[model samples]
Target chain A: MSSKSTTKRADALRSIEAIVQAAAECLGRNPDASLSEIARAAGVGRVTLYAHFASRAEVVDAAMSRALDRGNEVLNAVDLTGDPLLALERYIDAGWHLVDQAQALLAAAQRELPAGRIRELHAGPAARVEALVARGRAEGAFRTDLPIAWLINVLQAVMHSATEEIRAGRLNPERAASHITATVLAAFTPPGIPVPEPRGGA
Target chain B: MSSKSTTKRADALRSIEAIVQAAAECLGRNPDASLSEIARAAGVGRVTLYAHFASRAEVVDAAMSRALDRGNEVLNAVDLTGDPLLALERYIDAGWHLVDQAQALLAAAQRELPAGRIRELHAGPAARVEALVARGRAEGAFRTDLPIAWLINVLQAVMHSATEEIRAGRLNPERAASHITATVLAAFTPPGIPVPEPRGGA
Candidate 1:
């Protein structure tokens, strides 16, 4: 990308991210919180907020767009070893932590986040994760003939939901993540995969 | 078991449930929505609110106490079909619809609900669900070797978060529940389970 184009791109991304994050926090207080609330939180005047976002729905859509980007970043960064269960745990941990950091905003993103964009973002990484799971299944490290898509869908839920629980103080972060990981693996890992001993080896 | 005892128990349960549901609706609008808010929403005066709940925390706890009961009801009502995926779907669908009926209160409950009581309530149904999932893995319906606790924890997340989505209007009720159900099942079902073609074969 040319420097001018790159600079414009960077600035646009930054502005968009700030607006979305602010909106997320604003909406966290109330899903129905007003556009002015988002404007104030984002440090943008009404003109600026409107300059970037045309309406509440657009603002929500933009916010969701950024959150998905953040989600994808985490998905990319997490290490995925051959074991589907292990990779899933790491993925859930990374994903939840990302959402937790952005919980105020991500809270709103889940509902308004565009499915088409999310699916596109997920397509590459989800495929890789599925491949890992498939390999594990083939090797009998995970269950064979299990629906690969189901496992992926549930992991997304686990990460997304566990973060909410932690944000709400219903679960400690580590325990919450572990709890989700375990819950999923139990349903999917091959029959002989031993249940993880309870933390602290109790 | 006597009719008098049963009637009294029924009354307690109904009153408590009503108060909590009302409180939850208020909390949804305002995180800091007060005992007075809850009282008004519950359609009881402050005096009546206190008659059932001793404090704001108590109100939240009482409400969660009821919510946890409902969660169990969802768990118990899940049909245990030979196909774990189908059985799980029924469980999710039942729970999915109940989430937003009191999401704000649920969000609050995570903070104020009594830990000991909540933990106790969580343990029973959680185990049963885990057992069902474990059987799914053993019978080759789901991925094997994942932790049961984790699955249960994440299930709560998807259920509650979807409520946020629907309330925010990002997802319509039918689509939100279907998306969540499909996503969750994808996470656990064995690889052979096909992603249900969107719109049930259109």
Candidate 2:
């Protein structure tokens, strides 16, 4: 509670945040990158990294947790008060940015982490997506035949694929985010409804 | 040619097919699996493998080429004569089967092979898909607002995602083929048109 202790606490939090960010970046570039490499990238000492993470697995966990936390923040910031369809688009735009930032970590988490944990990490955004899809279906804005779960999976699929295309240099990052937004929104739109043309006519 | 020479030619072709199949299976299990391992799995000796493939890269190329050839056969077999929509669905169903079989090899190929070669391998199927989409668009069964190239990309994306889901065990293989077929067909379907319900309603 004292000023001295509070200052120490703030410094510790900053160091942890920096370490986690560096780990995510390193893992994104090389899934097999070592702990020492991550620490060096973080500009932290071995001792400091050890002080925060007990082992490599702990580092992986912290990095993935931080990335997912940031993704949830992005998803939450998409105002849910707007049109349900627009809300879905905003969520995907923000979601893909997080994906672009932490793709290696996300892919690693899918392979290395427990399914339950991965599901838990995704729960927040998934719930928001489900709600939006349900709203769209109820309002007859989206297809009713497709289950909410499947629709959510399709959205995630598009995001992952778009990210892959960008990383592979098959898609231009400058235009891909909006391209994904348009493509995915159109995919989600129900039959009997027409989506607006791509802005600027191509 | 002598009968003995003809027999030798048939045996050589069989051996080559067996070696390529073995390489694909081993690479699927371990992307870093060695040439010796592939040879052993093929029930052949190191000399035989060396005679067939000059190097690891050659093996990778052969495996990928074999896989894509099999995929083309699947796509070619899809009767394109019926309703365009039905033809598209049948193509997807058969295509995913090949994907399921060669996924590991296909993924390994992406990392191990040249991008130009990979594109070349995909060219046949991509052209077929473009033709199908064009037919649907002409019949007013598919959307025209999206470019044929982009639509083909979406189809590939959906296929990759479905395969990922199946590999992750998040989706059942027995059902995944149809699930993918439905989802992808819907993606290709114009916003204002409704795809028929799955054979059995979900």
Candidate 3:
């Protein structure tokens, strides 16, 4: 609790933050990036990295966890009480931001981690979306016959696909996010219902 | 030609077909499968494989070409003369067969093949899908607000994702093809239009 001890604590925290950020960036650029490369990018020594994380897997797990934490915050912030359709769109719009922020980590996580673990990371957001879909169905905003789980999966797939399109330069990033929101909303609209014009017209 | 010469040519053709099929199977199982392993799977010697394919790249390319040929055959068989919506469903339903048959090779192809080469391979099918989407739009069966190109991309993405879900055991293969067809049809239906229930409910 002394001033010198507090300073040391602050310095340690800063170094850890820098290392984690650099690891995410390095892995984003090259999923197979090495520890030394990450260390160099963080402007830290190997000793420092090893002191905080023991192995490459640990580093990857930490980076993914950090990314998921950021995503969860965005998912948490979407106002669930509003129009269920708008809430779904808001969640998806915010979801894309999280995707952009964790672009590199998301790809790396899929490649490097087990599916079960990846599912665990996504469970929270998936549940939130599931709730939104349930609400949409209740409000007659979404189809009632399709399984709720399938609808949620479609939303996730469309978002992931949009990310791929943007990365592949097939979709412009400016319109990609809004396009995903519109496509998803359209997909969920019930068979008997009329959908509003898709947002962000092509 | 002499009978002996004719027989020899037939045998050579059989060997090439066997080798290509084996290469695809092996690459599907292991993207970095050894040439010797592929030859063994084909019941041929390494020398024979090398004689037919100078390198692994040649083998991979040949396998991909073989898969694409099979896919083109399926695409060709879809009766484009029917109702545009039914034609689209038929194309999607049949497309799943190609996707299943080439699943392993497709994944390996993406990882090992150049993007330009992959794009070239997809060019034919993409054109077919784009034409179908345009037809659907013209028929007033699909939304006109979105670009035909984007709609085609969505169709491709949804199919690819459904394939992944099946691979991951999240979706039953029995229902996956139909589910995909339904999801795609629903996604394409224009605003103010009511699509019949999505094909496979669950």
Tens-digit lDDT string for candidate 1 (A69-166): 66677688788875556776776667656656666555454445555554564566677678777776777766553355545555566666666556
Best candidate (score: DockQ): 3
Worst 10 residues of 2 chain A by lDDT: A193-202
Q: Which stretches of candidate 2 lie over 4 Å from their true place?
A: A1-17, A25-35, A46-58, A104-120, A190-202, B1-17, B26-37, B46-58, B107-117, B191-202
What is the C-alpha lDDT profile of model 2 across B67-149, one tens digit per residue?
78878987887887668778887888788788787788877786678767887888888888788889988998777766666
Evaluated against the true structure, the overall lDDT of model 1 is: 0.64
- Two-chain DockQ for each candidate model: 0.10, 0.27, 0.49
Error of 1 at A176 (Å): 2.4
Q: B1-202, model 3: which lDDT tens digit per residue?
A: 8999999889888889999999878987777788888999999999988877877778888889887877887798788665777888888888877877677788778766776687788788878878878887888888887767678878877787777777788887888777777777778878767765655453
Q: Provide the clashing-pair count of each candidate structure.
A: 33, 1, 0
Worst window of 10 by summed lDDT in candidate 2 chain B: B193-202
- Provide the lowest-lDDT 10-residue window in model 3 chain B: B193-202
Residue B85's lDDT within candidate 3 is 76
- Sort all candidates by DockQ, best to worst: 3, 2, 1
- Candidate 2 residues A103-146, lDDT tens each? 88876775567656777777877888888888888888777666
- Candidate 1's C-alpha runs over 4 A off are A1-33, A82-85, A111-125, A196-202, B1-202
Q: Using Cα atoms with residue i matched to residue i, what is each candidate's TM-score against the true structure?
A: 0.49, 0.78, 0.87
Error of 2 at B151 (Å): 1.2
